[model samples]
Target: MQKLATFIRGDLVYDGSLVSDATLQERFQSSIDPEVVASPPLLGPKGIPQFRKLDFTRDPRLAGVQNPTLVLWGTEDKVNRPSGARSLQRRMPNCDVHLFSKTGHWVQWERADEFNAMVVAFLAEDSADALDFRRV
Candidate 1:
C-alpha cells in the first residue's frame, strides 16, 4: 500500500516538481482509505497478458466511429504519448484535440477549471464542429 501511494504521488507531478501541497495531502488521505486501498490487483496472470496484447494502432475500427469525439492529452504525460491524440484526431472524422503543455497524465486533476470548461462547451455543442486544436 505504501509503495502504491508513493508511486501515485510521484506520478501525479511532472519531473523534478510537485503538485500543490493540498493535492498531495488529499492524495495521501485517499490512499490510506480502506476502500481505496482494497481494490483487487490489476495485473492478474491472465489480465497481464491481455493488457500486453492490446494495441489500438493495430485496430481498424477506430476509423468507423461516427460520433463526435474530444481528445484531451497532456504533452508531459508519461503514460500515453501525445502522438496518440494526433493519431485519433486523424482517424476520427469529428474529433477535437486539446494538448495541455507542462501537464502530466492527470490533466483533469491538474487543470480542473480549464478541463471542466472545455468539457461543458463540448457537451453543449450541437453539431460536428471543426477540429478545435489548442494548447492550454
Candidate 2:
C-alpha cells in the first residue's frame, strides 16, 4: 500500500509539480480501490508480464483501423511519451492528436473542462473531414 501510494504520488504525476495534495489523495484512493487492490489487472506480478508482451511499435493492426480516432496525450507524460500519440496518428486512417502542455498521465483529470469540451466537439462533428491534427 505504501509503495502504491508512493508511485501514485511521485512517478505518475510527471515531475510532481502541477498536482495538488487533494488531487494526489484522490488519485491514490482511486488507485487502491477494493475491487482492484489484488486484481490481476492491477500492476502486480501477473499484470507486469502481460504489459511486457505488448509490442505496439511493430503492431500492424493499428494501420487497419478505419474509424475516426482521437488521440489525446500530455506533453509531460512520464509513462507514455508524446511520440506514442504521433505514432498512433500516423497509423490510424483518420486520427487527430492533441497534446496538453504541462500535463501528465492524468490529462483529463487535470484539465477536465477542456477535455470534456474537446470530446463533445469531436462527437458532435458531422464528418471526419472536420477533424485534423492540431496541437492545443
Per-model lDDT: 0.71, 0.73
Return the lDDT, model 2, position 28.
70
Question: Candidate 1 regions off by >4 Å?
Answer: 15-52, 127-136
Candidate 2, run of 10 with poorest lDDT: 127-136
TM-score of each: 0.67, 0.71
Best by lDDT: 2
Candidate 2 residue spans exceeding 4 A from truth: 1-6, 14-18, 38-52, 55-58, 126-136
How high is the lDDT of residue 59 in model 1?
56
> Could you give me the TM-score of model 2 versus the true structure?
0.71
Model 1: per-residue Cα lDDT at residue 136: 19
Best by TM-score: 2
Q: Candidate 1, residue 120: CA error in Å?
A: 0.5
